[model samples]
Target: MLERSTKIESPGVLKAGNPNKSLASWQGRKTEIAQIQQWLTDKNTFLIGIEGIGGTGKSMLATKIYDEIADFPKRFWADVSNGAGFSDLARQVLSEFGFPVPEQETQLVEALVGCLRSGQFLLIIDNLESLLQPDRQWGSLFYGDFFQAWVEDGGNSKVIVTTRERPELKGFEWLTLKGLQVDEGVALLTVLGIRGDLTQFVELVDGHPLLLRLVADLLKEEYSQDPDLSRLADLGLGNLRQLLTDSQVVGIHHRKNVGMVLVLDASFNRLNELQKALLLNISVYRGAVDSAAAVAMLPGSSAPEIEEELRNLVKRSLLVDKLNGKRRFDFQPLILAYVRYQAGDQSEAHQKAIDYYRSIAKQPPWKTKDDVKEYLEIFDHFYQLQDYNSAFDSIRICNDFLTLRGYYVDKVELYGQLVSKWEEIGARENRNYQAALIFLGNAYDSLGQYQRAIEFYQQSLEISREIGDRNGEGKSLNNLGNAYNSLGQYQRAIEFFQQSLEISREIGDRNGEGASLGNLGNAYNSLGQYQRAIEFHQQSLEIKRDIGDRNGEGASLGNLGNAYNSLGQYQRAIEFLQQSLEIFKEIGDRNGEGASLISLGNAYNSLGQYQRAIEFLQQSLEISKEIGDRNGEGASLGNLGNAYNSLGQYQRAIEF
Candidate 1:
């Protein structure tokens, strides 16, 4: 009854050649093939769905099984990589069976079903997901349920499908293909003559067959130029990781390989306008995005509307559920990069991402686990964008929060990136340029790279002097003092601090004066001038309190407590440290609280109060662990061990 497009071929196994022999070779999946074989040969089995993301070799596997199966009298295969109408599909299938395709749809359906019922046949449809639709109506038929009757009749014919999505039909065998195994991946890489720690290369690409093949080809070409593998080896993990994660690389193809851009584009083109927009929106994130972020990024759409679109995209295999049932989604790296490139005019989406992340980064000092999670996401997005101006602005806005929260490495990375951009943009003398230098210096200072810290500080100071900015000069001078103090050049640190103090007093900048006094006190304490340290700290505390700088006041109290402890005045130290701890708690400063707790523990230990020391150290450790403060955690652990040792509990100390 079906209108056949061509005559059927004689019954025999389908012959094949490995596609893209240079880039792809069929290495493994014998287990999967045997599983499909077991199901197809079973009398009760009616349908099989081979599902995976693009480039996982679904089509290849389907063809392999079709060739291996021996008993089918008639065989049919359709390359529906693009969407096809039901009539076209029926005609193609009928033509393969040496039957004429009928003009009438009802007659064709009846004839096809009758043919399958009477004789043995094998039908293989590749990319079946493309043929499905949300509405399901192809022409007086629901695509989702069209195969139900054929499958239910218990016919001799068996159907096998390869698709990117799970078919909505019931009672079908489903096999989801993942990445290739390590040995197989390595064999593929070897075909291209690209060398590395074969395991790490496979692991880097997560053993995704297409990715491994594609990246290996690129690296192979690069290696061909010199045959010196060390060039690639020099890239190291950081650079290599960046290169592999870039979706742009997947779009490349040699004469042998078809680019992933085309594969992903097929999936992307099937999406509706809103679904396409949503895909683009999510691609801006560095990693998985939760439902709330999705809703926030697209304010024009309601939450329900966004959710519905997300589900549809996931069903279409354009988006994936990163955290199952938790409502977080992600795209495959190549697919995301492809979608971002295809979705023209993405400035609006990029701006939306920037605003959302900026708001998150500006929130109160990231106290909770959720807060830290959100900031990490924000940092990831910023790092991925690599927009120097935006990154610098965010750093300035959240400077104190980043410093207090121990995000110094991130700061250093961001500043380093900003400096590169400044050089690229040729803005060596701008006001923001000096500010970036100063911040970078401060980051280096915090990391104990005092010499590097002084280099950047001096650069900032030079710029400020040329521009006649007294405030900038004073800040840079104070930063230089901090660096010198860290390097044990106390006299040099004092001279810089004295200059900063003079400028602060001359310019009537009370905040700068307090900061300078604090630096002087720290330098004197490090030099063993405990009484002089106390004098400067007292002055700094009075000024901070008078100026209503509660954060600064807390810092001064903590410093005073540390100075007193160094002076062997345990009582005085405990009193000041307790006050500092209370202030930090009131202000929701977990880092400050942890530091004060450690100080209190040390002061108590000095007084032979080992039990009190343990108690304080335990609390400090908990706070550090909660806030992800690694430096604080290390200090707390060390102090706890000391307290245990003092109590003659050597085993407990060793355990700690």
Candidate 2:
């Protein structure tokens, strides 16, 4: 399987705001509690804003803090999830604080203002994001003159506003909530008595308190039917995501009753049609989107208008900044699920995204550093839609461009899915099915799973032979040889390579012929047959040159260098490696460039040119790191260490 650069955590949590709460039962949020208490007791702070995504424990934290202040006699709490006007809010506030509810809107505002100014009071405004409406006649409760007057008055009063979105108004002390610690999240699940080892899933929820609680409750019900917990074990993080909003499972349990859709709908219902369109369109992309890509996705909307809407969505906590301060955004998983379903049949929008990305995939000379991320993103999106055509196309490009770019884990998963999709779509004898199997084989081979690689390659070979696809059969045979070579079965590898070479010649596929020739050379080299390896590499090089395949030519030259290095012909190895390195650089194939540098380093090391070996190895390491090739980085580091060891710099080698 391919490895990911970073393991992405699921949606984040909002911590408890008061220390007095039972950590044993509710789980620990000691630090957040301490901070909120400090702000509450401080004379300088008037308004405190608690902001986080839905199910992140915003309301829980606010309520905990509200309960903590036992002596603050004039206290009130209001739920604004149902849209309420300023007059209605003021009436509720005054009535809750033991003041008479005035009949007129003007009288209610006067009474609420008078009550706040008269004494120290605590006003907890729940769901402040829902109250933000540009068209509402009484939308100014938080943004207008009255709220400003309360802050300016600086009386013995503190107002806590719990919202998913951060209010635009200034002078408020903000406490942005984060996910809970692993231990706290585990404790929460333990308290719920969910019959499963949920430690792996703790990070999946990003320690969101409500999500943890709800998932625990759901798992409890599931485990009641089957106590083994193995039923839930097969469920991945995506399935865990479904559990959060699964109405059958979630039901009306505490904060779970509030529901993900209800929280999102508050902000969603307020968005203009264009903004809604933009959100729905972008939700199809499970990966990050930069401003330019987002703009391109919105065809008819003006650039400025789209930009403003994106900003608004960010402010409303609908779209989160993926690259902080980079104007790149991605939706929270729950929010994305909501938008994907609620945005009303976005097949056209999905088709638009597919077309745009597929066009990018078709463009040649894909710059590795710039285009790989986009290709991977598109690959993921296409796979999610079960669009096999686009998925295979995008992933094929990604296999070439991003195979060494530290996306092997993602590729393994994608290719495995593609294999299943081909089977599901009844593409048993289709060329794409063989290709998917080959891709899966390559992924497993990269991960050093030679047996798994062989299994896939064998499957591919069977399908190719069944369909009489001579070209695919050749490719499958060559790859089978590679998997065997990796497993140290050099004789077996050579047999497969010879078979592949014969098939390629029969089919007149010069590309396949050169590939099988190069692979045969590699198998021979592994078996220590230097002369035979050189002969095969020379033949492959000739075919590559005749066919004008510069990339293949470079690979053959590198293979020859490797063979020479094995034979202790250090100078000869360096000569071929230098040519290969130049060709790789000229072609902007960083993976190839890095491999050639490693070869040159090994050649120098074999010649006892330790200093020169160090130089080449260091260059390889730099290129590997720059190109995000972790396996290459590891190889370069090992080579560098070996060079340093030869020079008697043991400590320096250890550092490397």
Candidate 3:
């Protein structure tokens, strides 16, 4: 029984790395390979890096070179993207070279480098960009140092790395790989068993290897069912270009590659109903997905059946499968873009995805990274369904988690989409539309983009006034006041706060009234009016306590603490801030807790208690980092600097 289960499971695990066995037949890049071969044989060059965007065949070319180089005494290959780090690569090299592998990372790397320096070894590192920073620098210092040593001291041993970005290192011959020539593309299609002359098709795609292969596979599949080339003939270059233009896939647009979009559209069109449906449904996913998730997206489909379909899609070049600890499937960027564009009117599919993700998500107050990720999927589905209210609700539930956890940019993007959709539909006066504008404004405000925040706030205010929504009007006015205060325009902020206060009073919205009072306090505090700030904050605190708004009460307490600290009442400020911190902790408001800690740190620093101030600031920094609150993190660092400076530890202050 165990053996049977294992056999059944083994087929689903797609092995990764070193596609040498699978890529037996190859075409094109002969010129490029010869140049690389020359570089490899050159005693002066010890390293070569092939750089290109995805689907340009960087790995394929590297594998081809590896196969061609039989004269090398030793050859090794590692796919860096598939969980293979520098240490893993080192271990492979040491073990293969008959050297005893060291357990320590430094020792292992040293051993590998020593072995390479002593022999004629060739190492191929695939997807090297995975180990590189966005700025084209090595992500790991160990890898960088190892490579530098190889280039400087390795005798006769050569290393080739394939990446999307060229690493910032000297002593390496760089190859900026491009798509195949038209003739080469034609030959490749023929090798893939594509019938008919494909010179025009190849030219249309600009000889992009992956697009050609996809189109060829799709054509071959169609030909297998019916030996008719009429369909291929009918899709002339003109029609193909028109189809690509009409699709409007963002990836294709960015590449400005007419052939890519056309080929994807043709391939997508040739898929059977089930294949098309599966592709469209799975397009909702952002990244790698397992069989279970794929099965969930296709309701009423058996796991075995779905797995088989997934394999079929992989064979057709619609999906790419890999084993990164577990079997998963993904798409190339262009294909994902094309599929998303075609995924319209798939409400049932979107709902199925929503249900699947929701079923696996933890209940609210999402405690794990996975829970937050799942909610993002739910939000996406709701947005696709044009269910703006539910989508906004999803965002609201995870607002603090998103804001504090470095997902504020993502939150802003989601709100931008909502606003765009509402405007597209001309629903300017809709409550959700106004709410989305306010939410976007608040996001910008939190990010310190005060000008953008004011723009959104003004839009929301206009919409609220137009719709006679007094509560929304008050909220928008309060938000506008906050934005102005952030910009240091205290009087302008006060004017907005007064209007919001009047609206809140007229509508009997106790929460809005409290929020407006708090904004007034903040503006006054900014202007150095400590006594007036304290009075307003006290009023806000009373209203919040009456309404049982614990979060609001904490904010008011923190505001009063700041006002007292400004007034040089250090001990009194600490007392209020401590209370505020406790309330925030009890209510699980990490952002508020961070704010209170910073206030306490400032008060202690003012009192000449530098060490005590540092302790509080350090805690604030930790919380800020934990919650992804960049602004809070900056504030904590600046305050820590002040405290250290007060203690005459100028170096420590500078470091902070």
Which one wins on lDDT? 3
**How do these models rank on TM-score, best leading?**
3, 2, 1
Candidate with the greatest TM-score versus the true structure: 3
Kindly provide the TM-score of model 2 when superposed on the true structure, using C-alpha atoms.
0.56
Instruction: At residue 160, give the lDDT of candidate 3.
Output: 89
Clashes of 1: 6
Name the candidate, 1 or 3, with the larger lDDT value: 3
List model 1 lDDT by residue over 459-515, tens digit each: 888878887889999999999998898888999999999999999999999999999
lDDT of 3 by residue, 415-532 (tens): 8878988889889877778878988887777666789999999999888888788988898899889889989999999999999999999989999999999999989989999899
CA deviation > 4 Å runs, candidate 1: 1-252, 256-275, 278-281, 289-328, 354-401, 426-435, 538-542, 545-554, 571-594, 615-630
Worst 10 residues of 1 by lDDT: 1-10
- What's the C-alpha lDDT at position 250 in model 1? 66
lDDT of 3 at 485: 90
| Positional deviation of residue 340's Cα in model 1 after best superposition, in angstroms | 2.4
lDDT of each: 0.70, 0.70, 0.76
Could you estimate the TM-score for every candidate? 0.56, 0.56, 0.65
